[model samples]
Target: MTTASPADELALLTRLRRDLHRIPELDFDLPETLRYVCGELEALCDDVTARYGKDACTVFSPCKSSLCMFFDRKSEHATAVRSDMDALPVTEKSGAEYASCHQGHMHACGHDGHMAMVLGLAHHLAESFDELPRSVLLVFQPAEETTGGARFICESGVFERYGVDRIFGFHLWPDLAMGEVASRPGPLLAATSESTFDFHGKATHIAKAADGADSLEAGMRFVLDAYGYMAEQAKAEPCLLKFGLLQSGQARNVISSHTHIEGSLRTYSDTMTVTAKQHLAELAESRAAEAGCTCTVHFSEGYPPVVNDEALFDLARAALPDLHELPEPLLIGEDFAFYQRHLPGVFLLLGTGTGIPLHADTFDFDERILAAGLETYKKLVRIP
Candidate 1:
């Protein structure tokens, strides 16, 4: 029950975090990331598998050796916890000596630290499996930054194979106080995904502009109109639409023939999200016809809204410190929402003590949050 002294825990977590931070990988297809994690999991869990693996192994393993022994011979049910792997495409500017050596890749989202703390939890739970009643499953998910890695794990029927009863997960938030873990009972995080709009038009040379259609302008109009339409939804409820990129125009003299508008959408309500998708299709076609070009709006759905299980969160509330209500529904997105959808679970946001928010190039967080996360999850598995 008592292990991983504060000092030892800090030292081990620091090493794990630094090691991972140095080699940040992008969402999905992270072979190196998987290799390193498998090595670590090999030492802790009695059984491990790359469950529903994509880039990295969404590593799954039992903390205990057998069911009867895991339940202390009484036996209740099995449970699982998830920690996301993979970093944002952002370039590292944290200036740490161990900062990502890979160009244009960074763990600005604090996922590196999250991975370590969850590993710490895995070690703690595995070592104490004799005392812990519920058999624990550690899901080291990948591609959470862009797609629904949690969904992949669930769809793989890993839970059915393991006989898991509930799930638990968490994220780092710079807005909250240090050592504080906060959550909402239901819809803790919104459903978010990418929707791309492409416009195709005939290219024209600088001298003969009349011979071609400017698809770039057509894409631009659709982008502008989409913002206006989406703005109304935000005013009504929590929603977000940002056209992050426009790639089409090649030269100053010639208008672009083919243009792509890439962006993201967020909504707490499935109805609103679906509505936004439908609006995207309508606007793309309407604006394209207006500009005498063909336009297509393609949405690469990311993840569903995080539906927190009330029972699981109640268990966390009993175990965690400084539990509080979220200020509001977060517009930011996450793949953890995928886990909440499959099983009754809770996704917490551990306070990063306020500074630069996640996904920023300059993002940094207090390392001490690692201890808070470790203690919180360890207690979550042990007490309940």
Candidate 2:
């Protein structure tokens, strides 16, 4: 098959990455991003189709802008590659000329690079479509930064339609040196669940503290109880509880009537997630009762833990041998777990050299590191 050299491919990917970086879009409704991605797919794939999630029930809002591009669709078995299309809410401070033109939104997670590498793979595969043994599906998923678009695409019946046999995905990591890649057989990332606690109490003048229920006190008790619960759970298993926002009354003279606590929970095991969440709910109820207040727990169902298929990891290790085995599982979460749950798949990480971490205002990576990702995708495409 005729294809561009590695250097030329990297050059093309760099240009595309820059163009995408300039027009960063947020979750779900990415009209401009969708247009640009479809344009690229038109030039490379055999058949390009767009899919949408369930409607919003009221008000015609733009649904997820997901695209599925095919190459050699007649093959009985197909392999899928996913690239998330959403950007974070951080403003771009990366002094690069291709910095985000959309103020207050930026591709600080290297998703632009991810899209470019996948697009490059599409181009490379299109050049050799006749010789390819299996079909290929290029998934451009939106809203990875917020609601998971992967689940929506999966439920949309693309997998059944394409007869997908296996899938692969990767994320660029700035923690590792350039050219380094890492993955393990099981539990590469943690199962994550987010929660918000709303503590309610009777509001009254501070001078009459005995007559009023103090929500601020209830909130503090809940926090302490949560930490205690997390610590106890950690004794038996690995778990993390992080509190990001704690808010209470606006006036000091008034006894606080309401308080809100926002935090996230992470664990490597589904069992642990259940236990931790149960304990948290119980703790909130018990503490609220003791503090003479009411507590409501609002939990956001989150992505499952990313567990690599052991057999697929073998293929990955053989196809790309230079990978380093990760010492332990990561606390972060990935929606790629949704795909892994459906079929044998692997989620690999590419090192982009150390610097500002992902999601930071200054997050950016060297364009050359994309070569490692491109090479890996090329190798995976050839797997039988």
For 214-260, candidate 2 gives per-residue lDDT tens digits of 99998898898788878888888778898999999979899999999
Candidate 2, 225: how far from true, in Å?
2.3
Residue-pair clash count for candidate 1: 1
All candidates: TM-score:
0.79, 0.90
The regions of model 1 sitting more than 4 angstroms off are: 26-36, 45-74, 88-91, 101-105, 199-221, 247-259, 290-293
Best by the TM-score measure: 2
Q: What digit string (tens of lDDT, one per residue) describes model 1 on residues 1-384?
A: 366679888888888888888888876767777777777776554332222123211244332110111112134566777787788889888787888988999999988988888777766655565577666767787777765566677777777666677877788888888868888777777777787888988888858867888898888788888889988888888888898888987888887889988888888888998998998899889888876789877887677887678777777777765678776777777777766677778888888886687888888776788888888787777755
Ten contiguous residues minimizing lDDT sum, candidate 1: 64-73
Question: Candidate 2 has what TM-score?
Answer: 0.90
The numbered model that scores best in lDDT is 2
Which runs in model 2 stand beyond 4 Å of their true positions? 46-64, 204-208, 250-254
lDDT of each: 0.75, 0.83
Root-mean-square deviation per candidate: 6.1, 5.6
